[model samples]
Target: MAVAPLLVFMGAAFGLPAIAIATGAFTTSADAPGGVRWTLSNLTTSVHGAYLTALWGSVRLSALSALLATVLGVPLAQAVVTSGSRALRDAVMSASGVLANFGGVPLAFAFVATLGNAGVLTTRLHLAARGWSLYSFWGLVVVYLYFLLPLMVLTIAPALEGLRAGWREAARNNGATSWQFWRHVALPVLAPSLLGGYVLLFGSAFAAYATAAAMVGSSVPLLTSQIADALSGNVLVGQGNVALALSVDMVVVAGAVMAVYVPLQRRSARWLA
Candidate 1:
């Protein structure tokens, strides 16, 4: 009974919107005034040069940020999980909890304050003369890392915790070095979790908008920012529909992530067993 209402609510809200936009994408408006007419033209136009470029940029940025987050976050998670002191462990866990929920415009402002031209370190006497700017592509990568890494940590840390300490002790008793212990015992158990975590990180990075828009001011041509700009104009003219197409592109990418994620989830389950 509870499931029925949830399904009905979802269908009426998310499912209906998706169906409408999908229908609108292929078919233009003839009966509905200036609305899109149903044909291949709208989708073809949507798939053209600029949209493709933005899609590629979104994919590349997502991949790089996810990779960086995995590299940094996995280590931090391991440290947090392996820490001896309960207080230290709780503090680190608390910090990760805080970071997971921290996002949107305020996070962007925090980055700008710390890394902007007039920022603390940038404006300090020693660094001010070098003329560094954190508002460019590299800067965006930096900010993207800030958002995705903590999520990565949370995703993989549980897998790390599940690794049996006895296995590590057994390896150590056999004269295995720390590297060898991880190499032979821990890594095999953790690989599937890492892959799944990467998918989540990539998805999060690809969908991010507020931070990018706030930091770079939309000239950077991110797909999310493009969608935002498209929606900002006349609602009746329905240029907003173009943003819907962009959103469809996002849904397609997310579906691709799921394609990879489900198999990896099975693999992780097998590894755990």
Candidate 2:
């Protein structure tokens, strides 16, 4: 009886909305009045120029951010775990936690103040004299890394805490070098947490809106922005067509990430024990 209300809540709150959106995306108006008529046309139509470009950009940014996050995160996580005192580790961890949520419009504005044209760093370096541009794809990648790196640190830090020093000591006692120890022992144990963290990072990168919107200001489009544009004022004119299609695209991206994630998680569980 306790489970019944929970089931009903989940079904109505989550499942029902998902089904309604999925059905609405596929259905055309002709078949049943006030009912969605099923078709793949919406999805197909969303795969075009600006939409495609945004999709590609979002994916690329997400990949770069995830990679950067892993690189910066792992080291910081190790630092937090291996530190001497609980007080110091807690302080460092708390700082990273604050940064992990430091994205969206404020972050965008910060970057702009520092990295944009006529901005602090630009003038300091005289970058315009060097014929460099900071408003393109590379700029976006840098922005993503700022938000992503700290998140990676926070996510992997807990896993690092759970890992005991004995594993590495054992590997070294067996004459393993640092690289060999990490590859054979540490990585296997850390794989699940690292990969899970990357997924969260990637999803954040994928769904980012305010930062991208504020940073590039339409110079470079992103998937989330495109979706917003599609559904802006009137949801009906576009028939919510493009918006629906983009939602499906987002689902596909999430599904692809889960494909790798599920197996990685299983393998990590085995490695950790």
Candidate 3:
């Protein structure tokens, strides 16, 4: 009974909407006397042409952004974990928490103000002359990094903390060089956690909508943007079903990512346990 309210809230907020979308994805738009008929056309339509292109673009963007975030974030996390000052660690973690949640229109506006053609930095530094455009694919990557980097740091920080200092000390006692210790011991231990964090970052970038929409509109042709376009009647009159089908595709991708991540996370937990 204590969890009843929570269950009800979940059902209403997530379960109901998901059920609606799943049913709608398989429902036809034909005006029969009773209601819509079951059809697979929406799923077929969602996997071809512009929709396919958008899905592929989103996958590439998410993969690249997550890869960059992982490359940069792991070292930053290690530095924080090994820092001598508690104040600095606290400050960094606090700032990371704020930055990780800082996305959407406000973040988009901030990027525009700082990197757009008429932006202060652009105007002062003449970045346009350098062939820098803020409304392109690379620009979206920069914008995504704003949050993804911090999110990576936050995700991996706990895992870094979970690493035993004794392991490093034991490696040092055995005359293992820094590179050797990391390559053999430390990295193997952290591999699962690191991969889990990377997958989390990938999903974060994949599901992103507001920042992309606010920055590039439809110029970049991301899956989330295409889904929005379908639902908003911008692309076609009766594409709501198609939009639902695309959403299901996104869910499938997310499920596959988590399927891989859950085992890694469990392995990491076993190490910590």
> Whose TM-score is greatest here?
3
- What number of backbone clashes does candidate 3 have, counting pairs of residues 3 or more apart or in separate chains? 0
Instruction: Compute each candidate's TM-score over C-alphas.
Output: 0.89, 0.85, 0.96
Q: What 10-residue stretch in candidate 3 is worst by lDDT?
A: 28-37
lDDT string for model 3 (1-273, tens) is 999999999999999999999998999765434569898988999999999999999999999999999999999989998988899889999999999999999999999999998999999999999999999999999999999999999999888898888988999999999999999998998899999999999999999999999999999989999999998989788788899999999999999999989999999989966
> How many clashes in each candidate?
7, 2, 0
**Measured by TM-score, how close is model 3 to the native structure?**
0.96
Number of the top-ranking candidate, with lDDT as the measure = 3
Candidate 1 residues lying further than 4 Å off, grouped into runs, are 29-36, 125-131, 234-238
lDDT by residue (tens digit), candidate 2, 113-169: 887897899999998788756688888888888878888887777677777788879
Model 2, runs deviating above 4 Å = 1-13, 29-36, 233-239
List pairs with backbone clashes in candidate 2. Answer: 27-37, 28-37
Looking at model 1, report the run of 10 residues with the lowest lDDT sum.
233-242
Best first by lDDT, ranked: 3, 1, 2
Tens digits of per-residue lDDT for model 1, 134-194: 7877778888887688888888877888888789889989999999988977887788889
Clashes of 1: 7
Error at 260, model 3, angstroms: 1.6
